[model samples]
Target: MIEEARIKKNLKQFTFPRLSGTDYEIKAYKKLTKEVENLNLKYKVQFFTFSSFYSRIYPKIGFSSVSIILFLFYLNIHMSISIILILILFTILIISIILTRKPEKIQFITKMDSQNVLVKIKSLSKEKKNYDRIALFISHLDSKGQRFTIKIRIRIFKLWITSSISLTATIISKNSILRGFELIFYIIGLFPLIFNLLSTIMMLLNTTDNSSDGAVDNASGIACNLELLNHYSIPENRLIIIYGFFLLELKNAEQWVLDIFIII
Candidate 1:
């Protein structure tokens, strides 16, 4: 049977200023460790850093958009080889930036150290398969604060529509310099630029207003994971069950035990 009381205790203990890399997240990690230890369960803790405050792709698109915007500011309505060269440069920039966007590019300003709590229970049942297997019960201990919701999704769809039109217009327009390549560059880069720019604005707002209590979003998942650990045991011979508590999941930073899970 699942223990609802542990869920409440976790929710109560999770009530803190958990902004990814801040002291709040650290405290939460500590609390998680304590909980597992109280169960007399052996676990491992792995720490990692990620770009929580500022995303790398946001600024890349922003710079590309601003550059195209400025180039169009003084552009003339004429076709020229220079316009083609500009397109090539912009394409190269965008592609290279996207390719190089690894975890290391995370901004140094707010690069945060987050923890993953991992618990493994060997299966008790006999294995029928020829190969060893593992199963993961994944959950996140942190919550996210979002200031923008469906409005942003609607806007993104609108931007994509306009951007498609803009790209098509570039192909048919007579003046390749003024309207074709120039507008296409602006539209392509501006998509992410505008979206992330608005996201940044909402993030700024969320920074001041702490209205997000993400109990149902992910605290419930963690609570269920803990309950499984507390009340039940997996069939060891069938599979090795691994429970992982991920941080910065909302930030697209779940790279840690994933490789191990995939390899085995």
Candidate 2:
């Protein structure tokens, strides 16, 4: 049977601060390690770092730039090509500055009280014999700021719609003059894509919440894994559960894991 008390204990331990690279997250990891030890399960803490670019400011700037470009394109003004080149260059420079600016690091941060935190969990059954591994459980315990306004969202949607239409025109048009217009539309379409890319980047650097309160985002999953651990008692098979709290955006890693799962 699943140990409800143990699960609750894990949940309680996770309730504290869990910001990545912070004392809280480190504390949580230590607590997790303790729990694994109490259960006689082998465990390890894996430390990894990723560039904190996306979760900061790229999305807002990219979205704003795309919106402006789309607006200008819609107006049908025949500006000199030189002006367009200058504007694009200026926009790139602005985005580069916004994205590369680093936040001030906290120097006097308190160290996590590692005595109560759990760092890893492993199954005792696997230590004695070889077994086939099934499903991996994963979760992230981080929150981020989403300051995008409704107006910006609407603008992005419209830019996407317009870009799609422009792409279609570029693909189907054959006449030289129409082809030129299609090229212009195709170029406009790029703005939204670029904006989306930058928005994705912005999400990576903005970790603003406890990595452990990730209960809804992950504690539930941990509960499920614990249940799995209890029910699947086959000594010849194994399962690996990972409670991951990251400081960066998770889309790429999540997708890669999903793809691997599908293949396996």
Best by lDDT: 1
lDDT per model vs. reference: 0.59, 0.46
Question: Least accurate stretch of 10 residues (summed lDDT) in model 1?
Answer: 201-210
Question: Candidate 1, which segments miss by more than 4 Å at Cα?
Answer: 15-17, 52-101, 104-109, 126-131, 153-157, 160-171, 174-211, 233-239, 250-264
Clashing residue pairs in candidate 1, if any? Answer: 122-236, 123-235, 123-236, 123-237, 124-235, 124-236, 125-236
Number of clashes found in candidate 2: 24
Alpha carbon lDDT at 200, candidate 1: 39
> How does model 2 score by TM-score?
0.50
Instruction: Please provide, for model 1 over 15-69, each residue's C-alpha lDDT reduced to its tens digit, 9 standing for 90 to 100.
Output: 6556566676677778877878877778987777776424433443544453444
Error of 2 at 156 (Å): 9.4
